[model samples]
Target: MAWLWLVLGGLFEVGFTTCLRNVDGFRHVGWTLGFLASVSLSMLLLEVAARSIPMGTAYAVWTGIGALGTVLTGIWLYGEPATPVRLLLVVGAVACIAGLKLTAGS
Candidate 1:
């Protein structure tokens, strides 16, 4: 359950970050509102997940998921750069997130 919350939080974090790019420096009311709402929800879920998980581990996983998701979304939707180097970096981030989780377990 906690892990589920953490994943949801990560997803929302990605949502907010992507929406922020569309916000045009907050000039777009709809995008700004969506961004704010997603961020708020992400924070709430993160807090809930933190109750059972170590703060550092939870934070690392949350940020890793959000970053990887956001970059992938950008690449798919906005046609952002998707070079091999970028893909490798995303894989590394996933490895780090997995390492953190494994370490936390022991």
Candidate 2:
């Protein structure tokens, strides 16, 4: 279930990133706490997953998931530019992540 933990960790990565937006430079107390908690949980889960998954593969996947999710959320919720090039690049990142997973032989 290391893969599962990795996925969950990735999700928490997204959570912490999203929560960071609300931190208002750490002026917002509640959002700051949420961000801290999410970061802790995400890192904890990553550490657990790394015991079974190769460090490189797991780290790439985790960051890839977080980047992909955060970009999508920014486009959808924050009106960030959803340029065609940006979308294609994100998809390409997913493809690379998938390739990494498939080749990992885990």
Candidate 3:
């Protein structure tokens, strides 16, 4: 359950970041509200998960998921660079995230 919360938190992390792109420095009211809501939910979920999961592990997994999702979202939605090297690095991050999960012993 904690793991699920962590994953959900990570997804919200990605949501907040994606929302930030449309916030226009907080000038865009709707996007700004979305960003605030997402970030708040993300942090709340993280805190809940951390109560059971090791803080370091939880944080790493959460950030990894966010980063992985954000990178993919950027490439798909914003047309960001998806060069071979960039993708390779992303894969490496995925590997590290998997490694952390495997070793966490949760």
Candidate 4:
């Protein structure tokens, strides 16, 4: 359950970060609101997940998910370059995240 919450929080973190680009430095009201809402929910879920999961593992996994998701979304939606090195690094990060999860004691 805590892992689920952490994953969801990470997803929301991705959403919020994507929204940040659309926010135009907070000058756009709608995007700003979206960013605020997503960030708030992401934080809330992360806090809930932290109640049960080890702090270091939880934070690492959460950030890993967010970072990977943000990068992929940027490449797909915003036309960011998907360089081989970047993709390889993302895969490496994914492996590390999985390793952390597998070793984490529930």
Q: How many residue pairs clash in each candidate?
A: 0, 0, 0, 0
Candidate 2 C-alpha lDDT tens digits along 19-81: 999899999999999999999999999999999989999999999999999999999999999
TM-scores for all candidates: the values are 0.94, 0.96, 0.97, 0.97
Residue 83 displacement in candidate 2 (angstroms): 0.9
Worst 10 residues of 1 by lDDT: 97-106
lDDT of 4 by residue, 53-101 (tens): 8889999999999999999999999999999999999999999999989
Instruction: Tell me model 3's lDDT, rounded to 2 decimals.
Output: 0.96
Q: Residue 26, candidate 1: how far off, in angstroms?
A: 1.7
- Number of the top lDDT candidate: 3
Tell me the whole-model lDDT of each prediction, alpha carbons only: 0.94, 0.94, 0.96, 0.94
> lDDT tens digits, residues 26-85, model 3?
999999999999999999999999998899999999999999999999999999999999
Across 1-106, the per-residue lDDT of candidate 1 in tens digits comes to 8888998999999999999999998999999999999999999999999999999999999999999999999999999999999999999999998898789862
Runs of candidate 3 exceeding 4 Å displacement: none
**Cα miss at 39, model 4 (Å)?**
0.5
Clashes of 2: 0
Which portions of model 1 miss their true places by more than 4 Å? none
Candidate 4: stretches off by over 4 Å: none
Looking at candidate 3, the ten consecutive residues that score lowest on lDDT are 97-106
